[model samples]
Target chain A: MIEVREDWCKGCNLCIERCPIDALEESDVLNRRGIRPPRLKKENECNYCRLCELICPDLAITVISDDPDEEEKKPVKKTLLTPVGGKIK
Target chain B: MVEIKTADELNKKFLREGMWPTIFCNGCGHGVVLEYTFWALEELGLDMDKVIFASGIGCSSRLPGYINADGLHTTHGRAIAFATGIKAADPDFHIIVFTGDGDCAGIGGNHFIHAARRNIDMTVIMINNFIYGMTGGQLAPTAPLGSVATTAPYGNIEHPFDICDLACALGANYVARWGVSHPYQPIKSIKEGLQKKGFSLLEFLAPCPTAYGRRNKLGDIKKHWAWYDDNTILIEDYEKIMTYGSEEEKEQVKDKIQLGVFQDIQKPGFFESYEKLVDRLKEKEAKTKEGKK
Candidate 1:
């Protein structure tokens, strides 16, 4: 399931733009800030890519999985790439 | 399957409590840059007490206020000057100065250049939104050529300053520029800047949708990001073009904003040199006293 913190959403449409599966769209209802926050259109079709969460400037979007077994897997450590003109470690 | 963490859970680790809902406008890229900064800080495992965030007057300067750490919200265009004094007094403190294009490249241009020349032990993150967002959309020093601004209603005739190139020219030990679209790169660049011993300048090309985008007819937030994606040419690719391509090709790519580190070298910071001078002076004084005795 995907949840959006209504108050924090700024109506950037970044999540809507980056959603690979067309799972999100701008809602007609305005939040307290008078901005139209994006809402999940097709919850079941979501692949849980987390692109919205990563791309969002505001930490408004949250993606949760229904499977309890997924929680038991250890988080993989991501190694950062060395910048250009700098030596790689 | 990857473990999914909620936004609150991840944000709460670095963000200061009670500062919920930042002052940034919808689709403003400053928030993304700040998030990347927090991620870098966490990766480095820096003690918040040991870090001092100093900022000048502008939209980006407001970042220091949001973070729960010691920060000096100094006068307009003087963040680097204040940070210099702070670093000189306490060399142990990790000083990071958050500035905007107008604040650093316009009013504080001299300080910015001199700080890099001195190679002070500090990190300077200049968020280039192209226009003076806080001061009602005035044209900034980094504003693109032909861009519209309040001050330049007829479209700007002046050329924009390439901050990364300028910093690299001034002998800055570390310098990098990243657009807001690239999340991972900026975080890594920030982390590398933090670890470097000398002056480090990380220029983040943030989208000021309310100020810059609307004025330039860039449409919504997505269009602004698309503009960044289309206009920018990575430094690595740029270098390859320069090496192999003809003069015509090079001129065609000239308008593209070069991203990535322009310079990163090991150098003695100002404080280290200052301490050496102090030690030399003390030894000379002792020698003179012995001679008199």
Candidate 2:
């Protein structure tokens, strides 16, 4: 899941500007509630690659980890290296 | 001087099974900083549950994984911003943000200043490896001028940010810097950062064996650590290091920008202010409802 705090976003587009995969696209339309708010166009296309998370200037993103789903996130060494940088897999 | 212990003993007793992170290269400074962090956490008897690690991207961002905690790998340059949320949610939790020089000072700069302005209860362990180790070693905002990097093979023209000064200028409650090889100061400053009630930014001039390695001829981690021995000056010796006449002067001026708690001022923290805002909002809502009736 790619969670974003849109209001906290300054629309600097650093995340959009710095995203490598082009997975993040600027919304053609403005958000219903705000002015010039940035929106994530392709949520499913997000590879959980951490690239977006690696570029957000406001720390507004929270990309759920792969292999370790939200259920299995309870402080255990279940496995490694599917998505994040470790190669233990 | 604090009694420095053996690494073998420290590693065996303090480090968890997964603490030796794989994200960093063999001689990367992240590993050394992580080692030191764990040592500090252990020595201070920090509650793992009450401790949380936050970070922005770049090589140093890998710190959250090594330490077992309620970790947050936030967006680039926003570790401190995300940490502000976590710390605001529960002020008791010891929030620590790890970020690279570029991640903190370049892309995430505004967030850094705002977080400091608000004096959020958190510690940002900034690793100034001179060059950006991640993303193919670019010249970061903190990269020393004339330093060679992937982006500036001919030599960088950019002047680096003296991070301690930056932190100080921003009204950060506590500010200090240390070299990774400075034996005990990183841990000491970190401990103080953890204990302090408001924003504390600990800038560590860590030697990046990977990024800085191929350039400066400091080939290995050991050699880099050795170099720190010659360059790092403690804060206590600040006045003494200033008398050097030339750029070729010894690391004698290390005292001006070295290990030790530089600032520990007590001021109103972020949560304290946030709660007041929340209370005001709640009160305004209640008043509006009453007026409607």
Candidate 3:
């Protein structure tokens, strides 16, 4: 599954232009930034190659793999170490 | 083992608090480059505790502040010099410099050349956005010849500096140029540069749609990015064409920028040689003490 953070998206359309299969297209819906962010228009044609995720200049795209076998690979979210708090695990 | 993480996860792990929603304009390539660097760091399973991000004044140089790691926001054109001090003080620290073309090639050209010549162990990820994006679109040293900028109202008459070529000529350990259009190659190259024991220069030709693009009539962000794809040629293909290709083919790529690994050589870094010299002198001193005894 491909998820896009709409708030972070700057409507660059780089992912749409760089997609090998043209699976992504600009959505008519306007984001808060008044820019048209891209959405996955052709799911079947999408290869999940993660090219859009890689090329998005805004870091707005995230490709979540749907493979059942890969379910155990969830990563623990890390917290930032505050200046005086020392290291946080 | 480091799991295969998504872009969101990478950001959560690497990006600092309150730094989200970066200051970069729409269609800026700096965030893409930052993502690639994060991917490289994850693949290598590096400890951020030991990594140091150094930068000078520019839009690209603003990158280090967003990373959740130790960083130095130094004076204009002095990122390399400050990074050198950090490396010398503690050679174990992995130093990565994020500098813009103006900061690296224009103001810091002297430091850049000497660092590459000495083969200092640091990774330099220079984002050449053509114009100085931060300072009202001034003509940068890496700006293409005849490119229009605020300073160059008509057209720039100065020849652009080839950063990767300069590094290769200085015999830097690793040197490569890639546009932000290509993601995989830059990730691989950034990883290689990080792992290499000496100076590595990975120059990225990125688009500045707001600053450079607006002034040069490349206002449309998509077309500005497509321009990179159209203007650059892979170094391997370039070599093949120059050798056996017809005149027409050769002429087509004459104005194109060559992108690929320009140099990769194994050589002892400056610190390594200096350590050896110290060891040799210490051995001589011990021998003299034994003779006196």
Candidate number with greatest lDDT: 3
- The two-chain DockQ for each candidate, comma-separated, is 0.31, 0.01, 0.25
The DockQ for candidate 3, computed on C-alphas, is: 0.25
The CAPRI-style docking tier of model 2 reads incorrect
Model 3 earns a TM-score of 0.92
Write down the worst ten-residue block by lDDT for model 3 chain B: B1-10
Predictions in order: lDDT: 0.85, 0.67, 0.87
Candidate 1 docking DockQ? 0.31
lDDT of 1 at A69: 59
Q: Candidates 1 and 2: which is better by TM-score?
A: 1
Report how far off residue B35 is in candidate 1 (Å): 0.4
Candidate ordering by TM-score (highest first): 3, 1, 2
Model 1 chain B worst lDDT run, 10 consecutive residues: B1-10
Candidate numbers sorted by DockQ from highest down: 1, 3, 2
Q: Considering DockQ, which of the candidate structures 2 and 3 is the better prediction for this target?
A: 3
Error of 2 at A61 (Å): 37
Best model number under TM-score: 3
Chain A TM-scores, per candidate, are 0.69, 0.53, 0.69
lDDT of 3 by residue, B84-105 (tens): 9999999999999999999999
Residues B82-162 of candidate 2: C-alpha lDDT, one tens digit per residue: 887787677889888988889998989999888888888888888888887888888888876677887898988877777
Q: Candidate 1: which stretches are off by over 4 Å?
A: A27-30, A39-49, A63-89, B1-6, B246-252, B291-293
